[model samples]
Target: MKSIKFNRELCDFCGTCVGVCPHDAIELLESDLRITDKCTLCMNCVYICPVRALEELDEG
Candidate 1:
């Protein structure tokens, strides 16, 4: 399955990835972001992150 990975060092918690996710899979917590099982791996979050903090991961 494909999923989203967060780079905390690069993330500013702007919530752009959460806002852009079509599946409502991304969440912006007080301290970090969360990826739920609802994620469809659409890559919308990955593309929308201005800081490039979100990454796509392949788990085969």
Candidate 2:
């Protein structure tokens, strides 16, 4: 399965990922976005974030 990972260094704390996640899987973490629930692995948040803060990881 694919999973979402947050690049803390790249995040701008804009909350863009929180609004883009259709599954409500992400939240703000100390001003940055973090995965807070079950993620659909949709990659929407990854693509929508202006800073490219989110990444899709394959669980192997």
Candidate 3:
């Protein structure tokens, strides 16, 4: 399966990823962004993150 990897150190909570996600799979909480099961590995979040904080990961 494909998943997302978050680099908390690089994230700025800019909400770009959350806005770009078509599946509405990304959410921003008080302190962090969360990826839910609805995610389709669409790479929208990965590409939209300004800080490159989100990455696509392959998990077989």
lDDT values of the candidates?
A: 0.86, 0.80, 0.88
Residue-level lDDT for 35 in candidate 2:
79
Q: For model 2, what is the error of residue 17's alpha carbon versus the real structure, in angstroms, after optimal superposition?
A: 1.0
Model 2 clashes, total count: 0
Model 2 lDDT on a 0 to 1 scale: 0.80
RMSD of each: 1.2, 1.6, 1.0
Predicted candidate 2 versus true structure: per-residue lDDT over 1-60, tens digit per residue = 677777888887888778877888887878666676577677888889898878888888
RMSD of 2: 1.6
Those runs of model 3 whose alpha carbons end farther than 4 Å from true positions after fitting are none
**Cα deviation of 37, candidate 2, in Å:** 3.1
Off by over 4 Å in 2: none
Worst ten in a row by lDDT for model 1 = 18-27
TM-score per candidate, chains pooled = 0.87, 0.79, 0.89
Give the alpha carbon lDDT tens digit for every residue of 1-60 in model 1.
Answer: 777789998999988887887888877888888899998888988898899998988998
The most accurate candidate by TM-score is 3
